[model samples]
Target: MAQGAALGCLTIASLVVARWGGPAVLGEYALLRVLPWLTGVIASAGLPVASTFFLAARTGSDPRLRPTLLTLALAGSAVGLLAWAVAVPLLHRLFFPDLSPGLLLLAGLTVATQLFTVWGKACCQGQADMLGANIVIVGEELLFLPAYWLVSHAGLHGITAVVVAMVGGGAAATALSVGRLAATGFFTGRAAPSLRLAREVVVFGARAQLGNLLWLVNLRLDFLILDALAGPAVLGIYAVASKFAELMRLPATAANYVLYPRFARAERVDTDAEVRRLLPRALALTALATPVLALAATIALPLLYGQAFRGAVLPACVLLVGLAVEGASAVASAYLWGIGRPGANSFAMGLGVVVTVALDLVLIPHHGAMGAAASSSAAYLATSAVLVGLTYRFSSTGRVSTVVASRAEPL
Candidate 1:
């Protein structure tokens, strides 16, 4: 519920930004956020998810585990920072042609802070502290609302002000999250970094990171494509529309938050049975709720965003359908990850990315937001189909084995 409320606040804050700044400004803000987010994801090196697996499995108690994870996290951040430094100039030229280099540099700081914040939250999540984990997740956005208001009210406007506010909020959230982790005694262990542990973490994190990276790409690449093919105004409208569609997935998102750890623990027993039992219920609930959400969005979005955003309606509806499909996929993905099948998750998302990119390339130039919507929906459906099949196969085999084992045992 806390996570859900936080997501709601975020949606409201985004609406406030759109209303205050207008579409072009909103478009620029959306564009600016992409790089920092992508950078943070890359820098995480999939360790966040790996942390959840390891910590849930109680590996954090290992004297060497925590320090090794910390070292790897720092190393990943350094690599991301270096990559950002090299990419900024080209990115500025390509995306934000009018923004100053100083502002872009500030955005880099936001990325750095975000990486640390994600690491902190992952630590909390691994301990099965959802409240603490969510506080970190939501705190940044909560702080951003106030920070954005202050910055905008100070007579600063446009991308510069937006980026500055983001940096401030990110810094505060990172600090708070670190403090929270420390307070929880997450760092109290007598751990020292070890080469062997680090290598294991890297190997595990690499597979997870690759899957996470591909997933991020699948989610965010459309923004880049849209911005390149269409202008800020169009991208802005689509961004808002898509955000509305994204709300439909909040239940799934929250479910996965709790489910990942649960599934991770269940893996020690029989994950296939757990997946079979949990996934269908999640999918059914999501499937039932999505049309209602779509209806509400269709009526409410135009009213909230004004007719200037009416263009977003169809795409939003399209995306709602897609997100419904994604809800099922998310549950399956969590099960896969919980069972230590990062490679399979990565393969599924990679296929989705391929579909998304191909469709976006073929359709966005002519159809714009609608084309992007179609591509995303199709990709999600395809990914969900593949994952569902895999989960079913595994779960069915597990069920059969359990029955056979039961029958063979002396009565």
Candidate 2:
């Protein structure tokens, strides 16, 4: 429900942007965000995944684990802020075109605050405090919405408005998450981060982060390409379509929220059974939801974004199957990560990335957003197919049907 609400908030904000500024402005907003977002991905170093995994794996045996996560988040965010500042001179023009380099500072601060929420949620997941995790999501989205409202109503436009509002939301959300963490005794002990622990997180996190970074690129590479080849106005239209397509992902995203910590605590040997039980459910939900989401998007695109954005309808519909498959791919990726084989996950996403780049390059010139959607869908299908194959190979029974038949229960 919290995740749903967060998506709802995002949709509302997008609507406001589309209704107020049109696709060109929205496109600019999207492009402006990529820099800090990419930086955060690198700076995070997979700590969100690693912190949850290690903390849960410890089974509360290590009193210092909680504080160590805090330390890691702090150090990571600081590094990210510095990197974002440094990269401004070189990258702003290439990616953002005419935008000022100074805006990256605001973007960096927003992402830094977001890192705290990310770590806080990871810590909660490690502790199985699902409520806390949900609160973190809720607080950020809800707070950001009003900030965005204020900025928009004030007649602020473009990168400055979007990022300033993001900073407002992020800072407030960080305070909420940090206070929650402290109140819950997550910072109870004075556990300074040790080199051994840092190394452990780094070794494990680097592998997971590689897959994460690849997945991130696979997901967003088209946005950059679209911005470059088609320009921001076209990219803006595509962004709406992509956002609508994200509905198919909710089930898998929610599943991973619970599954990662649960899987991390289990032994690798029987992780296959866990996958069998959960993977089918996740895929089923994604499949069932996709067409419904497609239908809603078809109806809502014109209603919410006006006739100009009706073009997004086709592109969004095109993304459903691909995004559904991508949803399943994510669940499978979580399984691999939980079992300490993030390297395998990287292999699958890397192939998808190659496909994404090639097809996007080939398609975007002629067909624009439609071509990009088709390419994205194909790449997602490819990624999921390979990932599913990996899942089957890793499972001892070698066949999904065989395993289901071996059990008396229905999948």
Candidate 3:
């Protein structure tokens, strides 16, 4: 809860920067922000999912999981480096052609930053202290805000500096948190790295990475398309709206942190009964979160960003509907992935990503930011539907199946 509150505060400060900065600056900052998260998602892969289950299991019985966690981190780090080498140049030319060499260098650091931070967070979560994981998150935000403010005050060169700060902060925080965990003697076991366990974690992580990509595409493909079709300013508007929407999901995000490991433990105990007990409460929570978000986006958009941002209102509203769907889907996703159905989650996100790209091509050129919003919203809705359907079919409980069949049949 402290972490969540800190995040909420940090999120507000971020919005202040975005709101004050307006479209072009916000667009640039958005690019900076998205890169690390995208890389982090890739680096962490399915380990977050693996962490919840594996960690819960380890805490309960096996203490030999530390080496497995270390091995997974090393593997992810290697992959991250490779990904940075191949992906960053292409991405820079595509999304940030005017970027300075300094910003480019800073962006490169994201590969390492995401690798260490996400791996450590997953490890900590496995150790049942998600608070430690979130400390890194909030700490990064805290570091970036002030760092960027000071640097930008010095000169416009501040943007690159801010990016560097973010990367550095994540690395530092992760190191500290993980070191503290290690000092507790949790990772002192002389366990060998299990090829078998590594394979299982990597396989799941890879499958989950597919969904991660889809989510990446789903979340940002629209911005990329909008940037190409309309311009950065419009992308900026959508970016601001998207930031607020992320703020709205804080509750659901917090809940998932609590729920994933719990759900994982439950599945290990009895999959069917766990789903039966968890699904309704999850949906009910989603139900509660959606309208509050819609309301927040509605009220907060103008108030925070000023009348200049009134244009984001309609797009924000449209995006909130998509978020509502995604929220509901997240509940199901938590359970599905918890029970080891990452492939299903990946497949659903893949289909949704394809749909989003198709729609962006058709719609963004014609409609601009709002078009992007609609495309993204539709994609999330479809993705949510796919996840719910898959969860219902796969869940051992007739409960999820019945819920999908009766109340929320796919539209």
Model 3 C-alpha lDDT versus the unseen true structure: 0.67
Error of 3 at 315 (Å): 0.8
Top candidate, metric lDDT: 1
State which candidate, 2 or 3, has the greater lDDT: 2
- Rank all candidate structures by their lDDT, best first, as comma-separated numbers: 1, 2, 3
The residue-by-residue lDDT of candidate 2 on 279-328, one tens digit each, is 67777778888888888988998888888888999999999979876556
Provide backbone clash counts, one per model.
0, 0, 1
Residue 168 accuracy (lDDT) in model 2: 85
- Candidate 2, residue 212: Cα displacement in angstroms equals 1.3
Our model 1 lands, by Cα RMSD against the true structure, at 4.5
- Which clashing pairs does model 3 show? 46-205
State the C-alpha lDDT per candidate. Answer: 0.78, 0.77, 0.67
Prediction 3 TM-score vs. true: 0.85
In the order shown, the candidates' Cα RMSDs to the true structure are 4.5, 4.9, 5.3
- Encode model 3's per-residue lDDT on 206-319: one tens digit a residue: 676777777789989887777766767787788877766665466656666666666666533365566556666655665667677777777887787777777887787788
Residue-by-residue lDDT tens digits, candidate 1, 102-215:
778778887778788888888888887877888888896688888888998898887777888888888898898888888887777776788876766666677877878877
